[model samples]
Target: MSEERVGFFTDTSVCIGCKACEVACKEWNAIPEDGLSLTAMSYDNTQALGASTWRHVAFIEQPRPEGRTELPLAQGESTAQETPVGGDGELRWLMSSDVCKHCTHAACLDVCPTGSLFRTEFGTVVVQEDICNGCGYCVPACPYGVIEQRPHDGRAFKCTMCYDRLGAGREPACAKACPTESIQFGPLDELRERAALRVDQLHEAGVTDARLYGHDPDDGVGGDGAFFLLLDRPEVYGLPPDPVVTTRDLPAMWQHAGTAALSLLGGLAACFALTGRGRR
Candidate 1:
């Protein structure tokens, strides 16, 4: 293990809905373009992060409360009484560049029968294309719905956090191409401290809703290598509110199964002993 662990800190508040990260990822990784003609997803045609879509720029337009609804007024007064909106009332555009969480206890890595998915020195998870047998075990194991099989090739694929770039001491392609520095990459510990300061600053500036997601080391999946500073609830950005690793109970389940098997054998042995006594 490397002494230093690296990861991503995506400050979604600063994202400008620019798909530069998305394009750069595909270009640098040589990923195929998907759903070129699909029209179902508005603004974000790439949709959620998947096999080919490594970095998905999500555009969310939240409705601002109707400005100052007028109350009934007397005929002679001829004036509209303005209704005050609560402090929560606000309007803003939210843009987040979504990518693989690369969880510390990555379920995908846990479920890979061939060991194709493994953690790198930087603590980011990667999938070895050649080693993948396309058994599809990893697809359902991922809590974030990341890591999908390429239809044509039947091989699972996802963001490797640009492991190749990191090996060369360079930032991930998406982070490098970001014009707003929305995607910042560095040592994981340093990034967490930086993200905390950013959230505090936003709160001080009256952006009370700004909060960090997936930064807690003790979170469900032991925190994500790529965490985010989300302006709204995670689900609003198409992310799960509380994601838990699917295989967290495997050990307990196995223990119970083993105990049950022993109990059944003991019962069978007792029956055989009783029959032998009768025969004697």
Candidate 2:
């Protein structure tokens, strides 16, 4: 029997802009260094998830919400007042750790001719580096742009949801290292329930903009193994608002192509038969 599906539910509201998850992921996975040079744009050094960086913490500075004087505490258990607002419209920082969505209808798996990407018993998508043929098809097949081809070797890579750790009955390194429990990992069902409650709490606390993303099983990508709770629009955090599996239309496309090919062949055969009859 297959194991229960497991995944991550990241709450952006409680994220403190720390990159502990990123560091733990790199140390546990032995990912190569992406870059060390500071971008000077923000505290975000890695900038985004890539072949070398499995977990990325984004730092977004925006104007503080109007009439909001206190920041909601983690889990909405309490509120913290005296939030420091900077000059020029009183900015508030939005921090979120981004990773692969691990879509239920994974387009990367569909486009991977080499069978590099596969779904685990836990219903999480993983990539076998040895099996990857460097075809680069899966790179563009991903809707969220999570997967990337390494420039040095041209092999695609993305988050595996810590498949090895799951097999060993341990939580992922990132979740274990998260200080604020922003990155929660568990059975998909339980996580969904907990996320719903958390959203409700935030809404009751007057954070009306709190919302869930990638949690619906009926979504365009059939929901995601890794979902998020965001404080603002998905686009504000560099995520697509509505992501559909790229290969969703493949079956119909292939059927149409087959019909057109058969029609052309039949017409040519009729033309040849009429010519032969005329010659006779």
TM-score against truth, every candidate? 0.89, 0.95
Candidate 1, which ten residues in sequence have the lowest lDDT sum? 69-78
Q: What are the per-model C-alpha RMSD values against the true structure?
A: 8.2, 1.9
Local distance difference test, candidate 2: 0.90
Query: Model 2: per-residue lDDT, tens digit, 6-50?
Result: 999999988997899999999999999988556698777888889
Per-residue lDDT tens digits for candidate 1, residues 104-222, read 89999889999999988888899999999999999999999988999987899999989999999899999999998889999999999999988876655445677899999898999
| C-alpha lDDT of residue 176 in model 2 | 98
Poorly placed runs, candidate 2 (over 4 Å): 80-87
Point out where model 1 deviates above 4 Å.
37-41, 65-91
Displacement of the residue 191 alpha carbon in candidate 2, Å: 0.8
Instruction: Superpose all Cα atoms of candidate 2 onto the true structure and report the RMSD in Å to 1 decimal.
Output: 1.9
List of clashing residue pairs for candidate 1? none
